[model samples]
Target: MSTEEPATPQLQSTVSKPPKVFSCVLCAQRKVKCDRKQPCSNCIKAGVSCTPGAPPKPRSRRRRVIETDVAARLQRYEELLRRHGIKLDELDDPVISARPGVASASVDGANSSHISAVVGKDGLPLYAPNNLWSTLSDEILDASSDDERDLAIRVANQSLDSEPSTPPKIELELFDLDTPLPDLSSLHPEPLQIFRLWQTFLDNVHPLTKLIHAPSIQQEISRASGSPQTFTKPMHALMFSIYSCSIASMRDEDCMEILGEDRALAHRRFAGIAKKALTVAGLLTTRDTMVLQAFVLFLLSIRNVYDAQDLWILTGVAVRLTERLGLNHEPLLDSLSVFNAEYGRRIVWQIAILDGHTAGRARIDTSRTLYRGDTKFPLNVNDADLDINMRERPQEHPGVTEMVFCLIRCEFGSQLHNQAAIEGNNMLRLLGNPSTPVAEKETFISKLERIFEEKYVKHCDPAIPLQLLAMVMVKVMFGRLRLAARHPRRFRDRGATMSQEEKDSLFAICLMMIEYDNQGHRLPGMHKFMWHVKANFQLDAFVYILNELRHSSVGDRADQAWREILECFEHHSDVLTDTKNPLHVAIGNLALKSWGARESMLAHLGQTLPDGEVPRPISVLRSQRSVGVSPGSYSSVSDQRVAGEPTQNQAFQVANPTPFDSMDSTPIDWEYWNELINASGIMIDETQYQQPVYDARAMNDWK
Candidate 1:
């Protein structure tokens, strides 16, 4: 009304101005005030073109329709297929849908229908034309009748009931001990061949335990050759066992040439024959010393071939028989021949060694079985020093015969007396008792250290045979390792807890042991011993050194140690590849993995360092050096000396007293003996001491 038309009456000056409320399109979209000029303020700040336009339209509010039925059906089908381990992607075939009542159909010129189509006169349907059930009797389709339907349901129910609900279990066959024995005469080799094998056994295996009197065995062999019928089953078993081990100990190529077959196969055949002879001879039920000796020999023969548990159980049997026959007690010199009594003493000590060794290896506590107070160590003399009549006694010299070294080893057996300590030292048991007092743990360590110094260090001769020296060193090192592994502060920083000197000493011992093992094969008769145990010693050293490298703060030392260990491993690569000792092979591969991991860590560290900076040696705590002790020289003990009494010159003495000492005691430190036993690497679960079959392949795979 106030426009130019109404103002026409007063037409003086009625000019109209543009509205300020209107804005440019950009400003309206941003909901900001605009100047309404050609280029608005907001458009100028945004550096965009400005244009006049209408307001934005409101979005429609239409509701979406959902297919709930289809969704529910799809979920149900997915669930049904999952129950049978079937996936949607696997159901590509039209005939294999998860939905029920959806039978596939086929089309033909004559008929096209689903698989459930009506049957024809020939009892065949066009649908499912290739189905074999189409030719079945029409009675199959007569279930429409009440009686037929009831029968069909009953049959289906019966069939379901008959089917096993769980998968069938597999059963393993047991060893057949009753297998017929091979012909003894046919199995017996020529006289020269037998002599050669016997010599080989004497040179290589007998030194392990000089239980069998060589002269007596030779006499028996000579007599048996004169009269074939006199060659008893025990004797046959003994010869076969020796031959088997002798052949097995030879170089693979040499064994193949001698046996004209693969070394393993030949050994198997010989071992089988030996086992049969042992069964037929009834040695397990016999008290004959020859049979006992033969059985023990058989145990040695199978040390590397059979299950460790089997050997352990067999050793137990030998111990029991020896005890029942009074071998564990001093022989009555008045009642028995001197040769027989001496031989009995030898056999008893041999069994003791075997018992202790097997128990240690199997991780089985032999404190109960090995406690023999009256049993004395055999005389430190060679087999040649004694006559059949025992009238000639050779003058005893230090380290002259193998018995001297053996008795030195036997001295370590005394530590087994502490049953609680032995049981507590177990790796599994130690790990479980994490909260055990540090002081209490130190007591065990101190005890082990004392035993090591007195028995092995003070009493062991450094100049002893390389093999014996190696054995002593390995036993001592293994004992130290066990104690360290059980130490409460083992995982703590080295400088804060375990001194650098202690670490260096431990590492040095490991290096020495590895070097010793590298040269072990060169030792005379060393091959006759359990090479697996030696290999395991190498592995243990490797593990300890690896731990050192991982924990050592001194970068240069750690790097140097790694190089030495890696070189050691490479040097023994041939032995590691020997398939005969699968355990060693597995340990070798594990060592390689550990080495690779160490190298990767080193590489990472190298990359993380500053470009031009040299790595400085980290602060690794060093400890004071203690007095270096060597093994004591062996001194002969008189037969007149009471059992369990340390010889006048011998440095080892029974430090700790046990409750059973007054009952039946021996010089053997049951605790030290136990430690030495475990050093052999023959681990077996106490619960599975008598496992019927030990799957070595499974053990290999497990490692």
Candidate 2:
């Protein structure tokens, strides 16, 4: 081994290994860790790309945060300027424009040794003021005053125009949002036009701007107010009011920023404008008084000063105002009335909903349940669907008359004749038993009857009229309608249809009832009918009744129906929390099973079958069918035989004799079983029950 056989090469151990680290191009350039991937973390942070194993580059040194004497001194001056409402940004750069306190001298005089000889005590040359040019100084002074006034007027004008255009302009970004408070002087450079420019600026800016530019605006405003300039002209006062209104509506936040956060300060500013509007309103002639009453009321309402009294005052003035103005309608008063009425109705409903005590039990929950479950069936009425939106009167807004009707139906037990008599008698008595025409009395009864009839009548909608009638009946008959009153007779009678004209007349009456309730804004027991009917009745007949109620022009039951219908479908119950009301599970099951289709055949039966014939299944079913003769012919002899001694066996027997009967010489009772099965609608496999020992009644007892 020691033999120097080609001297053994010195062995050296060497290891090939993977690179220890990788880097992205950006990270390497920044001299930071790479954590290299396709896009390394460092690269991603820098929003650049990475390349693995790239050689790192040296990073440039960062600039130092050194302070210069000039910058430090300038910042101090800017801070001081900010405190005095003089923005440093307003200053010129490179000292081109004259500084406030600096003075400029004539150019030729500046270089004259003789002029320079006129020296001050400190050896600085004495210089006359720029205004030393007597004529030019006067002109310049006059121009400056005119400019300030112009800006002021412009600001005021802008404030006036801002009211109506503010919301939309702000929304559309028509103006500079970042620069809400623009420098009026910059916007209008002419010194003489400054006042008008300021007025425009004020008008365009928020009323709160007064707090920021208080010194300037207040000074001008005070000067304007003190001067003999009287806004006695109607146009001037009106313009002033318009401006004031716009100012009143400025954003509270913006106002708070200018004025202290104390609302009293804002209120003080608002009071000035509010008084202006009130003054304008009072100063206007009868006709013009209500020109901006809507806006006035709106402002007052927001200010917490508006009330029913103010509403009435404005509305009262409006009656004569429109007439005097020669306007066809008092839109102002109309708008006021509508607004007040809506708010009033909402208030009434809120109170009603909150009131814990009432004579009648709260029927909303039970009604909802019944409507959701049992009500899906069509009432002999028409087109009632699970989606309540299809109904005529919303459950919540049943008209007073309809509310009266709902209670009546529930109270009188759907007995139209009996209830009609009682209601008519009561109404007659209420009319002081005066002979107010037989038709009026009859009309009243008919109204009551229509209300009840709708609950169980074909194609009838349970509208305001019906609900009102129901409510009335409920009141009259106490809490429960005498079940006996619904005695079999009422359900069986199928009556003739009313003429179109008559239906229209009834619809008109319903509308009147709704209006009445709306005006009163308080009808006892009436609203509950709306809530209950909406909550309860789901039968097609209910909708039909509502639609029919709408036949009359006066029946404004659509809204009531719309709301109730919406609630029925849209108002969901929490399945977990609503234990007593397993409405969700039940509704889900029903929806799954029926696919939203109603089994409304029963409702039709309620409308069709006569009261006494309610128990007869054939009568119930046949009422909805067309009346005509059957296809078979029967002889008098066969009829006689069928009438006499027609036992169950003979009742089911076929006319012709069969081979099986002949083989027995005794009639088999199989025919009875067959007839029973047919009547019961149950199919029996002959092969399965052919033992001939099947009990017919037991087998088809479902009947």
How do the predictions measure up, each by TM-score?
0.52, 0.17
Off by over 4 Å in 1: 1-179, 222-230, 331-334, 368-373, 391-399, 415-505, 522-538, 550-556, 567-594, 597-681, 684-703
Error of 2 at 345 (Å): 26
Find the 10 residues in a row with the least total lDDT in model 1. Answer: 618-627
- The local distance difference test score of model 2 is 0.27
Per-residue lDDT tens digits for candidate 1, residues 1-703, read 5465875755544345434446777776677877888777778888988887555568955321133224323543553454344544456666555444333222221122102224321243222221111111112212224443233333223323344212122111113443444577677666766776777677666765677778778888777764545787778777887887677666567666555677777777777677676766776677677778777776666665554444656777887888777776653532566566777877766677676556545444444445363555566677877777765445665443566445544543333223233455643244223345434544554565565465345644545553465455435444443434332122312113443334434455555555555555455545555343342444445555543433231244444454555555555554333322223322332333333334344444453222232211110000001111111111112111111332332211112211110111112111211222232244322211211121122222111
Model 2 alpha-carbon miss at residue 60, Å: 82
State the lDDT of candidate 2 residue by residue for 134-228, as single tens digits. 00111110112444323222322332322321111101111123212222112211332234323533443212111121233335444544331
How does residue 579 of candidate 2 score in lDDT? 19
lDDT of every predicted structure (CA atoms): 0.47, 0.27
- After superposition on all C-alphas, the RMSD of every candidate to the true structure, in Å, is 36.1, 40.3
